[model samples]
Each structure stands twice: as C-alpha cells, then as structure tokens.
Target: MSDAAWPAPPQGSCTLPASVEAEVAILGAGIHGAALARELTLRGVTCALVDKGEVGGGTSQWSSQLLHGGIRYMLTGDIRQMREGLAERATWARIAPRRCRWEAFWMPHRYWAEGLAHRVGIGLYDHWGAERPGWPAGLSLGHVPKEAFLADPRGVLGPFRGATAYADLMTWDRELTRDLAASSEAMLLDFHEPEGFEQGDGGLKLLHLRDRRDGSARQLRARRWVFALGPWTDGAMAQWFGETRKRLRLSSGIHLWFDAVPGCERPWAIRRPKGRILFVVPRDGLLQVGTTEREVEDGWVPILEAEREELFGALEANLPSLPWREMLVWAEELGVRPLVAATGATTHLSREAVLERHARIPNLTLVLGGKLTTARALMDRLATDLTGLRCEASTTAPLRLWDGQAAEIR
Candidate 1:
C-alpha cells in the first residue's frame, strides 16, 4: 500500500506495526542499532530493529571488548572526540555493571625515553578523566619481574621495566546487546534479513524483509531508516547512486582468549617492536587478546590462522616465561571493524564524530567509526537530528554501561 493510503500509526503509541510499520527502521541489530533502539524507545519513538542474524551477534560481540578512552585516539589529539567519548564511557560504566565494568589497563614501558613519552601521554589521560566521572587515574609501576604476569601467560613480560595503569571498561558485548533488545519496546526481529526495497513516499524508507526463520517475506515501511549495519553497511548502500562504498573502510582485527596468563586482574597494554599496540584484556573470566588493524578489500574472512600464528608468536616473544603453545589453544575469534573514513583520511583517521546524513538517502542517516565509549553520544545526536520531532537527549548522561550494568537496564 502507498504510505498515504496506509493508515498512519499514532506518533507516541505503537499499533501492531502493520506486520511492518515503524517510526524508525534501524538496520542491523548490533551495538550501533541496539543502542539507538534503547534511546529512541526512552524518547517514546516506535522503532523496529532488524538484523540478518542475532542481535549483538555481529562484531560488537567480537570487539577488543574495551570500553576504553581514546588513548590511541588521544595520540592524534582528537580532543572533541576524546572528551565526548570519555563522557560516554563513564555513562556506559555507570549503567551496565553486569556486562560492563571498569578495569585498569597497564602499558609497561621498557625504554626509559619511551616511558617518558608515555608518561606525558598518560598525564593527558588522567587530566581528561579528572573532569569526567567514570575514568580512573593512571598509576606508575616501579621495577617488576619478567614473569610478573606468570599468572596470565598471555600477558607481557620482561625488560623488568615499570608499568603505567590507565582507566578502561570492558563488557560482555552479547549480554549488552541482549540487554538493549530487552529494554526496548521496539520490535527487534532476528534473522529477518532485508531483501531490499524502494524509496517510499515523502522521503520515507521501505525495506523488503525476509524472516529467515520461517522463510516468510514482507515489506516494512518506516518514516526514517538508519543504516547502523556495521561493516555490511558498505555494501547495503549500493542501491543509491550518489553514495559510495568508499564512505566506509573496513578494518580486520583478531583476538585470542586464554585464562593461562598469569598476572594481576588489571589489564595491560604492551608496545610491540613493530610499532603495533596490543592489549591483554581481562574480561569476565577469560583473558582476551587482540588487534592489528589492516585495511580490507571486499571480502569477509571468518578466522585467519596466519593472524593467530603471528599474534601468538608476538605474545610468546614478549613474555618468554609464558606457555604460549599451551595457552594459544584456549580460544580464538575474529571480526571486522566498520570504519568510516572521510575524504583524505584513513582508518587511522582521527577518533572524531562521524554522524553524517547519507548523501543519497535523504531520510537515512549513517553512524560511522566511533569508540565503544562514544556509542551513546552518537545515538543522542542521531535521535536529535532525525526524530524530526526535537526532544532533548538526556540519555547521553543517564545510561551507564561499565561492568555491564547496562545489561540490567534491559
């Protein structure tokens, strides 16, 4: 039915969705869309979130699992992005203690000179957190042992140098994803993949959905549509002429899990000789590890044994005392980071605000690369601009996620 002929549902109340109506139809039920769902519902907007698979089943679950400040981001001096992210980090920590909790991350420095540079950088972190509520202060470590992390063999060792501790939060992405799905009255359909759709009347967006579970198909119409589809968003915008897949550059990252790592529960960051930054994150009960950033062409590879092999070697070389062979077998997972790049920028681009309306889809908005800490802020901006009905976003402050307390919000 044409939008004008179809009966319109009341703005504040949901009427059955016509087996397909939504005030806001957000694509991809991962963190990006999930968080947006929560905020929209809190604002009383009727939202329908659709995912090809499970909610939070995407890379959101496979993240480095850090709700960390932009320490790496700070390296580029993206002040506006850093400050805003710190705020969101604090908020996520406050609300979601179950799945999101604060933990201290250590980056042990070997060279005295490099230590000095890190000290200055950490000082900036401390200063940044001083104005914010949830961030913790960076602590300086004196001399330590080679096997200090013997408790967690997957951790950094050697050089007997001091370590610095900075504040960061980690969360169970899946639990948080589930929490968001539960918190919203918004209809979230899993495995109901979008087949495609034509632009609707009056700038409305329509989607042809296939309920993969039952092999049933239907069309969904919405006043506004959101493409928070993570990495796949690059291809989903194909129907539009003006939009280019170049709008986003996908990055591949890998992580290994092992409980064998010896050390304090405090997470630590280690600088590899290759100018790469790696983290040995302590999550829930598993020792999670990861992350080399490399650009991608147009393919999705599940797990790369090469990445695991190289990363394992790196960890073993850095910490000789650990049983790398034994610990490496614990568990390994992989995923891609949906990175949005602006003109003349790369994935290493500044950790800044990436809220932009789709150049081609007038009724659609796209949220690009952002820190786990900044997702909420991104949601707030999205709601303010697209809701067409201006409502203040108190959410940027009220919701907290550290320790995964946000899971409880659901």
Candidate 2:
C-alpha cells in the first residue's frame, strides 16, 4: 500500500516553529517515542516529539510485525516479560482491531523430546493469558499427519514428531507507530535532528534542533527530556550528553521478503541448527522469512551475500521441494535491536526496555532495549517514573489514534 493510504499527521506539517516550549521533549519518533508522546499528551503534558527522519521510518518499519506475547521468553523464566507482552497484545487488539488480526503460529519439532518440551512451554504460555479478556482460547498441541504436513511442501521439514499451534496477533508496525505519533496532541517534527542540549534555569533542558530539509535551526525547551533513539541510543548519548559507557549491546537482524508461499498462510517457527528460531510469516500476500541475530560493532549492518546464502540453505534444508529461487525477491530489511549488555550469546539477550537516569542531569532519561509489542507499557512506566502520575484509569479507556479510531481496552 502507498503511504497515502495511512492516516496523515495530526499537525499536517513538519515545519518547525522558531521557538517552542513544552513539558517534555522526546527524541526519536520510532514506536517508543510515539507511544510515549501519546501517553504523556493524554495526561495533560505538552510534548515535542522530534525525529531525524519520518516517524517510524527507521527500525520500527523493519520489525517482524508480530504482537506476540514472547512465547520463546517463557523458556528462559522471564515471566514478567511474557505477562507484559500478553497484556500489551490484548491492548493493541482492542484499540487497533483493523490493524491487528489473528494468525496461527506452528512450531514443528523433529524429535519427540523437543516436541514434549514445546508442548509444555506452549501450555504455560496459554495458561498465563487465560484470565485476560478478549484473548484467544483453545490453543492446541498435537501431531501433524504426514499428508497434511506435506500439503504445502514449502519450508516444511519432514520426519518431525508433530507441531504446536497457537494464535498470535499481527499488525503493520510502521502504520501503528505513525498513527500513534500523528494522532497525539504533541508537536510531531519530522526531518528534524537534535544537535545538542544545554542546561537551562530551574532544571529545564534547552534543545538545539536542526531541520534536515534545509539548514535552518530552532530551539526547544522542556522540563524533562527522553532519548528514545532505538539503535542510536549510544551514539545520541555520546553526541549530546558525552557520558556513554556502552549501555546497550546492539544486535543486527535481517528479514527477506518473497512472494507468498503457495499454501503457507499461517506463520511457522522453524528451529535452526544453532537452536535459534526463524519466523516465516505470511502477511499482505508476502512471505517474510527472517531474523538472524548477531552482535554488531555498529548499527550500519546490511544484508550481505552470506546472509542470503544462509537463508537459502535454511529453506533447502527444511522445505527441499519448494522452488525458492522461483519466488520473487520482493525486498529486504535490516534492523538493530538494543539489548542489555551481558555475557552470553546475542540470541539470549533480554527484550526488556532499560530506563537510565543521568547522574548529573536530573531531568534527562535514556530509553533503551525495547520491543514494539511493549512500547505502550514501557512508556507508561517511564511517564510514571518521571512525572509521578498514574494511568490506572486510562488503562481501561479506549486509545484513539491519528485517524480518530478508538481502541476499546475493555
């Protein structure tokens, strides 16, 4: 779909005013910043949300677009992350039903032992969200018949024990991010980059912003500031605050798109030799197969020939019968996910958001390591921590986006 099909910005303009003042200045217009703008504006706080590029034009557009409740995280005993994801999934379904729809995710197992573990893990996942209203029930785990499994003959590995199927929500991550930013009362400044900041009187932050279209500059002042730079968190911190100790460990992920697999409408979670999960999602008549996680020295990772070869090998190993070469190579996306720096493989990094308050800068906050699924909850927590305002009542209230579509939370 063309960009025109989605809702336009509420301000209908990205032109920066000469001077603007607000209660908060949010840097980075990705999903996190957009969601924070919505949450803050609803609480009667004026905000200025500035982005170096178009809103959601960065890594937000390159997400897997699954509103899943982190089913894989359950294996690691990350119950809090799983529960937050479940609640956020339901919230997105309520407010953006048109944008979200249910898809059955299949986890095929090659060994009985692995299948048993999968069944037990999925059972726990299903039970965790049982009390949440409007959630899907009756998730089943069973063996797949040989004939049924071979029906598609595309990317389906044979001699498997069985599969576990469960429902998860999917949406257009870019559109949702745009809608949240455009609909908020906050001033959305696209194509504006933050040059630096200066400490102001009464603990106010004076931000210097530059227009990317032209060389013009503007000044913005706010009581509090948030840096939601996503993968650029470390760079922004070093450039602006000059106090960076490597708070985030960046991992690069790549997704390749092809024409929809003939009969593979439902998404599949295929396990790789390294025990990592690769998702093959079908959406909008396109088949998206991805996500290889590897630590990166910087954020400028691209889709190299080795990555393409790896994907082709995966397809050949799993679904040897499918003519993968014949499928149209639609597009490719590369994104960097900020993970908490720790000793382990990049695949084992937690997906939780990290909120760091500057020791010297009292009113400044740095947001890092978050997922698109939990942006709203993360922002709510940040708002409460910064402003001491509670959003208990608004949790059940319908959230209206840029197009004036109300998402009923109840």
Candidate 3:
C-alpha cells in the first residue's frame, strides 16, 4: 500500500511547544508504549507518548503478525504463560475481531514420533482453551493424511508422513498498534527524541527532548514516566538514564515475502532442523515466510544477505516444488526481539515484560521485553503499579479497540 493511502495516525502538533505537561510521559511509541498510553488514558490519566520515529514504525511494524496463545510455550512447561497468552488472545478477538481472525496452522512431520508430539501438544492446547471462561472453543485438531495434504496444495509441499492442523490468530500487528495509540487520548508525538531525564521540584520528572523534524529543543514535565523502548532498552537506558546493566538479550528475526502462491494459502508451522520454528503466513495477498533467530550485540534491525539465504534455504527445504527464486521477492521484513536477559540462549529468553522501577527515581517504570500478543496485560500491570488504579475487568477486557470501518475515526 502507498504511504498516502495509509490512515494517518493521531498526531499532536508538529511544532514542539517550549514546554508541555502531562500526568505520564512515555518514551517509546512501539507496541508497549502505545498499549501503556491507551491503558492510562482509558483511566482518565492524560499522557504524552514521544517516539524518535513514527508510531509502530519499529519492531511493531515487522512482527510475524500472529496473535497466538503461545501454544509453543507448552513445550517448555510454561503453562501459566501459555494460559495468559490464550486469555489475551481471546480478549483481542473480542475487541478487534475484524483486524484479527483464527487461522489454521498445518504442522507437517516426517516421523511418527514428531507427529504424535504435535497431536498431544495441540490436544492439550484445546483442553486449555476450554478452561478460559467466555472464550470461544478451540478448533479440533484434524489429522491429514499425506495424500490429502499434498493434494490440497497441489503437491507443492515436500514429502512428509502426515500433518496436524489447529487454529490460532493472524493479525495486522502494525495496524493494531497504530489503532491502540489512535484510540487513546494521549498526546502522540512522533519524531520526538528524548535526550535525557532530570529531577524537577515537587517530585516531578523533566524530559529533555529534541524535535527530530526541526532539531529544536523541547521540555516535557510529567509526574510519572515509562520507558517502553523494547529492543532499544539497553542503549536508551545507558544514554538517557545512565543505568545500563544489560537488560535485554537481542534476537534478530527476518521474514521474506513472495507472491501469494495458489493452494499454499494455509499457514504452516514447520519445525526446522535445529528445533526452531518457521511460519508461512498469508496476509494482504502476500505470503510471509519467516523468522530465523540468533543472538546479536546491538538493536540494529538488519536483514543480512546471509539470513536471507538461510530463509530461502528453509523455504526451499519445506516447499521444494515452489519456484521461489524465479518469482520476484515481494518484500522483506526484519525486527529484533527484545527478550529479557537470561543465562541461556537468546531463543530461550522470556517473552514476558519486566517492569523495572528505578531505585533512585520515584514513579518511573522501565519496561523491557514484551510481545505484541501480550502487550495489553503487561500495560495493565504497569498501570496498576504506577497509578493504583483498580483494573476493572468489566471495563478493560471488553473495551473495543476499533469498530470496523470507523477504526480510524479517532
């Protein structure tokens, strides 16, 4: 889609005021900050959300775009996280059903042991779905014979014993982030960079900001603040807050796009040779094949040519019949996963958001490491911790994020 055709997000004045004041000041406009702004605004708290770039123009723009329940977490014995994700998934379905929908995921296995594991995992997932009250039931897992699987995609898939199909969600992650920020009453200041922080009188916090558009200095004073910088957490903390103890384990992920191949519209979650998972998702007339993971030193989102070849190899390994190289590459998306630092590999780091309250600074919360699927709950916790606002389940859970065609009305 052309930039002119895209819905313009709710933005405050381009000319930065000499000084601005708000109840809360958020330092990032990615999914985490956007969700936090929405949560605070919904509770009648005024907010100023400042970002160095456009809203959802960072990692949020380049997600795998699946609002799944984290069924894969079940394999790691993180049942609580899985259930939390599933509950949040159900809530997203309730509020913005038009933006997201359940889609079938085909898991093809070459061996009986692998196929049995998939079946058991999916069966447990279904049973767990039943535990969430008021949520829709999960679709039953269907065992597809090898012949039927090959026939449906016109024998495009490589050889496999059989496959199991189940359901999760597919969404427009970038649009969802934009919609949340737009739907809120927070002052959205894109292209504004936070230079540094200072303690003002009366326990107020001062943010030194430079308006990126004009290179003009601006001041924002707020009683509370949140640093939801995602992958930029480490660098931002060091430069702006001066407390960088390595808070994030950065994992770079890349996705390749191609023309929508006929009969391959169904999404696939195939296990790669090293136990990593790759998704084949069809969205907006393009097929997105992604996501390879490796630990990185910085937050630079790069689509390395080596990684491109790796994904191309993965796609070829799974769907050898598709003429991927001959076809034009529709697009390529890349992002860094901001996972909480841990002792293990980057892939094993926690996807949960960590709320770091500054010991020296009062009423400031730093958010690190979160996923798009669980942003709402993370911000809800942050809201409660920062404001003592009672999170009313009746009001928050069912709040409509967007109402069909009127989604951009705000």
| lDDT of each candidate versus the true structure | 0.65, 0.76, 0.76
Task: State candidate 1's TM-score.
Answer: 0.82
Clashes per candidate (backbone, < 3 Å): 39, 1, 0
Off by over 4 Å in 1: 1-18, 131-157, 239-244, 273-275, 342-347, 351-353, 388-393, 396-410
> Each prediction's TM-score against the native?
0.82, 0.89, 0.89
Candidate 1: tens digits of C-alpha lDDT, residues 42-118: 78899988877777776677777766666775566666666666666667766665566666667777778877777
Runs with alpha carbons beyond 4 Å of true place in candidate 2: 1-13, 131-147, 155-161, 201-204, 273-275, 399-410
lDDT of 3: 0.76
Name the lDDT value of residue 166 in candidate 2.
Answer: 62
The predictions' CA RMSDs to the true structure, in order, are 6.9, 4.6, 4.3
Which stretches of model 3 miss by more than 4 angstroms? 1-16, 130-140, 145-147, 154-157, 200-204, 393-410
Error of 3 at 97 (Å): 1.3
